[model samples]
Target: MNTIWLGFSQKLLKVDRYIKKSFTYQAIEKTFAIILPFIIIGSLSMALSSSVFSKQGFFNQIYDISSWLPYEDVIKKVLEIINTVTMNFIAIMTAFLSAKYITRSFKKDEQIAGFTGAIGMLILNYNLASFTSDSNQETFLMQDLGIRGIFISLILGVFVGYIFKWFSPRNKQEKVDQYTFISRGVGGLLPLAIVLGILIGLTLLASMINQMGVNGLFYSLFRLTEIKSKHLIITILFLAFFNSILSGVGISGPLGIMQGGLDDTSIVSNLSYSLKHGTSFGVPFPISIHTIYDSFGSFGGTGMTMSLIIAILVASKNKNSRKIAKFSIIPSLVNINFPLMFGLPIILNPILMIPFIISPLVSMIIGYFFIYFKWMPPAVYNLPRTTPAPLMAFLGTNGHWSALFVSGIVLVVTVLIYIPFVKLNNQAALIDGGDLNEK
Candidate 1:
């Protein structure tokens, strides 16, 4: 068994290396790495603002104590606004980061490229009619400004980055005073002008396409808002697999697509059924990716790395691994695992890849069965996506202890599954001369 496992690990490492060398993959990885702090901040704001623990969150819970606590309302409002601005604008921010990394890869001015990409993103979603003489033809929708826009934003980022790279003065060694900021600013003129021109042209082309009764590229790409039931489980499994694989390469797949395009038809349908029946006692929610998978399958963020964090804390003797676990604990509680994911540098590590991909799938199945068997009530409340696990189950199921209990069980299972994998990783690190103790 050891020999067989060794052979598989060698092959997996080779594939991992090949993937790391891909320019596209590297761009995506670096984009996520750059934007990770935003994701964490946004998630933290959402979690704090959510009334998961109460009927009306922090404000309502503290309503009666208003006289004692000054500025409760002010604090609450600040958190909500923070959530709106940061979490709500993730798509546009991602566009900026993607372009920044892609342009940097081409050895061009990344800041200029990033600014251009941000402008392009805003223009693509901007309502021309609202700003122009056609006031009666307002076409901008609020949904398009958020998660739905991520896919197109990423594509546009790459497009704008490439255009900037193409127009940048290449292979020219001009002697200029390094101390002069104006010299650098002037150097960006050609690429900036060209990128802006193309952006304007694309906007006109999109408008023309809209006039022909076609939804245009922006609408077509962002309109995948539904994931119907025919192959729902299969879709969940595939998403779980793909998201893990992408995260293994340091790309956030859920932030890119799954979280954006996933439909909640099952959750909605089940809630409607429960309402009409007047009792949710025996009826269970259908196998729902949003309710079960989102709440439990991704217990510790993208690759469900929380379990791995636990394993590292409990079983690993390596001080570096323990330190990672220490730093990751608080973030893990909030369902943010990027620190561990990137710091442990799970990206492209062959040994950790296997269980990283499999753990979520296993957890999804476990959660589905628990709900299907009526071991817990269906998750009716649309809890915040950033709501931490087990508690997410509790709030989502409307104060069901059973749901929380089931979530606890799934978390334990996840931890157990990750133990051996963590052990293997630790052993390999030790063999490779990894520092086992703190200096």
Candidate 2:
């Protein structure tokens, strides 16, 4: 009775902390990690497809069959080179920015301690991909955040460091200090502040520039989008997934090419094609849910759009996580998609295990139910995913409008499903008292 009573006591004491730690933050972060890669790719693909068709430019002949055979295969190679280069550049930016944000934001400790702790966790987070990948199960790094090597590194680094600080030797004396802001790592705090300022400032500068000129930004956007290699859904899911693993060791695409022998496998592409042409939406096969996006002519992606919403909604609810939340999402919305992914580490976390599986299943089930009930039309349309995905899906359905409504329904359902799990996990975390990262 006493032991049982103690267990109940612990549960009661930590319930609020659980809610604080989990919920919106985890879901959104997972959303960020997986979907951002596709957003970049899809946006790039749409840009290319649009340019090729409009101007008869480099990518204009994408539909031409001769290009992939002997003489024209070079076009494919060039496109491959461009994609690799772009992905690499992106990986670097995400790494540095993500690393700094996670470490600094969650630290809430002395400047160097939080920063160093964040850095320390970084290495472990990157390792999580290999740490979690399995043949039967989807990769542990999570599909929403493709090219996860960087995001995980950033996330784990921050998490571990903050945890470390929480366990800092100053426990007894420090707890007595009333105002935390005045505590600082006090002296080291200034440098930490400067580092954070610099990172934020640089990101803002980039955003302002991108937002300033619409046409130029659009053109740049087109060029980037046009740089895709083909069978986009697959590319986003598999190749992007593959890229995450390689990124951990700093071995990006060309770097892999330099290694000699190669193996080709693209599960996401095969799945994407099956989702579009192979399987009918009503079929019980799981991929039909993708048709949810397909209901619109322009909706080529389902994973990222929903992922972003999940991340945003989850992060907003968790007050402690907002520091990381606020900055990550804006840039994420634009094309550089890391803010949400690593900021929260939603993918492999045990707390989210239920929702990750449940949300997708529920979304597909509800989507199917709506279609069957005649409350919503079948998602038979096809279109590229660009700009904002969910909203685009709404327009592509020829204003089926119901798809948008359905998407909203799915988002709300996902949140409802994910909340309790997040709460349980967050409470576990607080009681366990954070990662080895500084508090």
| Most lDDT-accurate candidate | 1
Tens-place lDDT digits, model 1, residues 1-439: 9899788766765665566566655665666555556555655555555533323543335353445656766766787787677656666786787788787777777777888888777767666556566557655534555544555667777887788678776634433334257656775788778777776677767777663111135344423544444766767777677668867754454434545535446666767776787545554545656765777778777767888888888788878778767767656665667566655657666778888988888888887777667776666666544456657777776688888887888778888888877877776665555431211
- List TM-score per model, in order: 0.67, 0.38
Residue pairs clashing in model 1 are: 51-57
Candidate 1 CA-lDDT value: 0.66
* Alpha-carbon shift of residue 164 in model 1 (angstroms): 4.3
Which tens-of-lDDT digit does each residue in 1-439 have in candidate 2? 8788467546644553455465333323433454355434533433443333333432334354344435444544554455455443343334344434443444434334434534332322222224345645432212112242444434433443444345433433443345455554564454445444543454345445563122123223323432234533333234333333333222222212321221122224434543676432333322232343223211112223244345545644555445444544433332233333333444334444344434544565566567566675454334433234445335434457677898777666666665555555555656655443323
Q: Give the poorly placed runs of model 1, Cα more than 4 Å off.
A: 21-34, 51-55, 58-69, 80-105, 109-114, 132-161, 174-189, 206-281, 284-286, 300-305, 308-312, 315-357, 371-387, 392-405, 418-439
Q: For this target, which candidate reaches the highest TM-score against the unseen true structure? A: 1
